[model samples]
Target: MPSGAVRMSRKRAPEPASQLGDVPERKRVSWGILISQGSWADRSPLHEAASQGRLLALRTLLAQVTPVTKGCHANIATIDHVTPLHEACLSGHVACVRALISAGANVNAATFDGITPLYNCCSSGSVGCLELLLQNGAHTRARHAHLPSALHEACKRGNSQCVESLLAHGADPDLKVPQLGSPLYVSCLHRHADCSKILLHTGANVNVGRGNDSPLHAAVRQDSRDQVTLLLDYGANVNSRDEDGRRPLELAPPGGPSQQLLVSFQGSPRTLCQLCRLRIRNVIGRSRLKHLPRLPLPPLLTQYLEHM
Candidate 1:
């Protein structure tokens, strides 16, 4: 249109969407483009970064997700009632947890089985995650399909720290579930000797037995010497009978400290176990002693003789 110089040709516009050739086979990305693309590297980077404690990489990848999709993550299923938040909390993924919470994930979401993320963390000995979930308003009283509560899981796992944290956050140790008795019963029944001690110190029921028997009955059935000792120390009724009329002593071997069962019942079968043991001990001791050469009594033997 002018004489001074040749006019430059106009650039052609981009082809219309319908004119593209099968979308040019869209390059398979190694990482997600908005969502994860068809690239294993894309999916693996997050896990690898997390495993390596690469906080910066994790943050970068997480930040790429658009705000619209932020709260769309779910690691669990409708059938199982679990979520990614639950897994992260249970596995002690502190950074992932923080990211999930910050992304508006539901902290109190329960699994199909009624287990919350907080319960998993407590059961798996993740005190930090437990605290995190509680701080974010995770319910401590949430129960699993078969579990009682976070308190029950903590006690069952023998995690005293988790138990303390749950209690401090207002968990009910005595909260009774339908099948399991109390959190204390869960502790004693699962052979958590130290947990039982803590529960007892906190006024948990000493004789509160669940299932078919009292806690004493459960202790004796396990034949856990430490549990038996603890229960007795806590003033468990040694003579307390279950539905089958069995005492704690009935479950013990003949020589256990509680073998006598220590209570009398009118018109009931008398427990002569102590007399029977004394007779057996005396016969065995005398037979063994008769074979030994006469010697001066040692200090320990003198003490025993004096006690006898």
Candidate 2:
């Protein structure tokens, strides 16, 4: 198969461990049975153990297997190219993940669908597994060709902890997928206010999105008043229009909170203080906004600068 290509195997229910063959009663077993029988199965025993978070079984398998580089079974993939590492990360089994990585599993291995172990960790909201992958050199920016970035996946799932972990590890919040636009856009679409806040605080481009659909546009479409307020606080352009030429206020449903809030903003001019705060935040840039608390200012003034 071509690199990173996934091939679907014939559908078959997972077989029980009893049918795989008997082994000597010990903590660790030989790889001969796993290699002989699992090669033709949908997944290897290692994959099953990792996916189920069977730490002891995983460790025993790892101990018995030779180095992956020597054609050992550590990095074995299923018919669909899903590795044990992928299984472990997908299931949020940190111990199995660490064991797989220690046994020389490829941390950045991509499956047929282009989903990397790091991406699976984010999709599963496994912050521990995600961090373990990053610490072991998983590519933070690895894309699945068709799927969104790891940051986008975390935001899509409304996983603020995963979002924070990805950002702290240098994942780009603005990295646009073909249809997903920016992570902020996805967060707003899902009404994940906390994720949106984190993305904005981390310097994501508030105006970036698919076509003309800015984060503000998405927030309004979702009718999330809190998200709209948060976006406005972070300097999102209230007058920004979508692809259909409808501004955020125009997109708001009639008589809804979003509409009410938007109408109010439209009727009343922004305060000079609010405008100045927005200007300062814009000038300082999103990446540097976090440092506002350390500036030589009073606590109240610093809170204002941080938009607290």
Candidate 3:
């Protein structure tokens, strides 16, 4: 045997709950070891096998564990207030999630901080977990501490599948939180083209800028021609001013490829946001009305403004 290592001839089970060190009282538990040992759900042989990805073991556990435990929503050590189902959903273990849900696990159970199983999957971009949660009646519009809706996560990460899934299930694309704005705004700020497109198609306010400005301003700042065009085509105002008296056109970086100045219809800086909305809505409305081809700016709008 090596000087520092001891080799055991027999396999050993993990430390029992009682023999294990003290379980701290906080929030957010790690199901890693419990899932690793396969008995995290109550020392059931089926749980052990399921933890190991044993399909038959999972089926058997789904049929057996609940009957024995009477569908108890027990905590896994690492997760503060989350049950085994939360861990499964957070880890994207679809089968395990299904088993837990089938076993009467509360799909909407939240951790102490308001994190939910759906939030975990959404933040991680796990479509499988998302679908599982949705199918099991998960709250599609649920919010959590420090996190917006799952749609916000999907938009921020540019996860098309999750966005589509959430929208199809009636998740409000226009939903807003203090930290993250509308899904369209988040997508625009992050330059997530597909996600932004999806949000626009789903009736998100393309012209409604987030925070101090609109999506047009965000696209201009990033000099994202594609995103800018998409926003414009979908009804974002090109002339909308923010709190700083800067129009989306004025905020365009040193390089961009579109220049169109539609003065605020109301011609009032006090209502600049509304003016920008109107101009953008009119442009987009006309385009839609006439079925015009997508317009591509001939040169960066910033450079054009310099000449004017």
Candidate 4:
């Protein structure tokens, strides 16, 4: 046991008729006795089994215990309110997660700190778990006081697959978390070019400055030429300034790619084609630009429009 971790004593509760309706008559045993027999960090057997990806053990445990309702009336939680579904999703155990959900676990249950299974799965780069949870009607835009959204977590971890899954499931590409800015900013800061590209194509604000620091500033600070180019293609302001009034050009290292690109953008005027693309995107709106590739245009032109 860890020094500060609390070990709670388990107590038996009456089984819900709705859950036990399918079971045949037999000698009733206290489910709490099975959970209390081990010093397993004060977590129930279902939590331990789900975390370990033990499908058979999870099924047996679910058969014995009452199913969790949508309101989390019967789901097991640790001292911090971390549930079995949280454990399963954190470990990327798809089968265990499905079992728990089929047994009526609350998909949107949050811990004491507001970390849901979707956030945990995204943080661990578990695209399978993410998809399953979304299919089960998990809230895609659930915000946490301290943690960002699942899309932000995927971007921070550079998990492009998870980012795609989150975006396809209706995650807000521009959701700004306190101190984290937006998903695009986090992706640029970490040099996740693919993630940043996805955000931009999915309608993230190109000029959403974080405390006056534009994402272009973050790209320049990280010296990611690919990210910088992508941002500019999406109409990022070249003269954008940061909190200390430092422009991206000033932040770029001399003789680096970012410096050269910014200098070129400053000197050269926009071409007619570039202006047209920007105008079309603006008129279509960021929310609708995601369908640009599916429009009735030539594939090459569509690729150009999507910045592919």
lDDT of 4 by residue, 177-277 (tens): 87788889999999999999888888789998567888999999999999999899888998878888888999999999999999998898778888888
Residue-wise C-alpha lDDT for candidate 1, range 189-253, written one tens digit per residue: 78888877666544455777664466777776666777776666555666678778887667766
Q: For candidate 4, report its TM-score.
A: 0.82
lDDT of 3 by residue, 1-308 (tens): 22533111111246556744453211113332332232323334433443344556666655654556756633232324545565565456787777777777777877654667776676557789789889888988665435446778778768888898888887877788766667787888888989987777655777765676788787777777778777755546555778798987677654446333223321533345434544554555421522222344454532221111
> Once model 1 is optimally superposed onto the true structure by TM-score, how far is the C-alpha of residue 74 displaced, in angstroms?
6.6
Worst 10 residues of 2 by lDDT: 24-33
Q: TM-scores, in order shown? A: 0.61, 0.83, 0.63, 0.82
Q: List the residue pairs that clash in candidate 2.
A: 5-112, 6-112
Judged by TM-score relative to the true structure, which candidate is superior, 2 or 3?
A: 2
Rank order (by lDDT, best first): 4, 2, 3, 1
Q: What are the per-model C-alpha RMSD values against the true structure?
A: 21.7, 8.0, 12.5, 10.6
**Highest-scoring model, TM-score:** 2
Clashes, model 3? 13
lDDT of 2 by residue, 258-306 (tens): 8988888778877989889878888987577767877888999887776
Give the Cα error of residue 77 in candidate 4, in Å.
Answer: 0.5
State the lDDT at 103 in candidate 2. 82
How many clashes in candidate 1? 6
Instruction: Using TM-score as the measure, name the better of candidate 1 and candidate 4.
Output: 4
